[model samples]
Target: MKYTEEHEWLRSEGDVVVVGITEHATTQLGDIVFVELPEVGAEVSKDDEVVVIESVKAASDISAPLDGEIVAVNDALADNPSLANEDATGEGWFFKIKPSDASQMDDYMDEDAYKAMID
Candidate 1:
């Protein structure tokens, strides 16, 4: 898994990369109340806003972590936004993207580095 400075986490699974907000991000956002996900099959460029999350404290946009095609989105978040707080790294994942350039992942930090940055 790799983490971005924006507090998004990426996990490679087969040919797809799964994306989600880190637990620390959820903690800062307070309790999530709404989620708007990108449509599956949409092409996206790195840093493009793709997902929108609304928490009691504020609303935030989650950017595309890499240049890729959005292959799947977690529908569960739409029905129950708190899933992001309950299991951020697992069930709370936002989407799975098929990266156009896998090397784009190299720019992110590993878990230890992410922890250090957050600390």
Candidate 2:
């Protein structure tokens, strides 16, 4: 998985890419109370606001780090918003998309770079 300066993580699985906020983002946002995901089939550009996560502290936007078409969303988060706090990059993933270009994934920060930004 690769992370972005904005704190989203992208895990490419075959042709689709799974997206979520990093654990660091959840930590900064406090306890997540709700998450809003874009509908399947929506086309998005790089850095577009596609998901909104509401924490007890404030609502945060989760943007697409690459241009893509929304394919699937993590509906589980609707009923389990705290999953973002417990496992931000795992079961708490927000959505998945079929990217316009696979190589765009490399444009985001790697783990080390992301940590440095947060730290």
TM-scores of all predicted structures: 0.99, 0.95
Clashing pairs in 2: none
| Clash totals in order | 0, 0
How many residue pairs in model 1 have overlapping backbones? Answer: 0
Model 2 lDDT, residue 85, Cα: 89
lDDT of 2 by residue, 1-119 (tens): 79888888889899999999888889989999999889999999998998888999888888888888999998999789999889988899989999999899878888888888988
Q: Give candidate 2's whole-model lDDT.
A: 0.89
Per-prediction CA RMSD (Å): 0.4, 0.9
lDDT of each: 0.97, 0.89
TM-score of 2: 0.95
Per-residue error (Å), model 1, residue 115 = 0.4
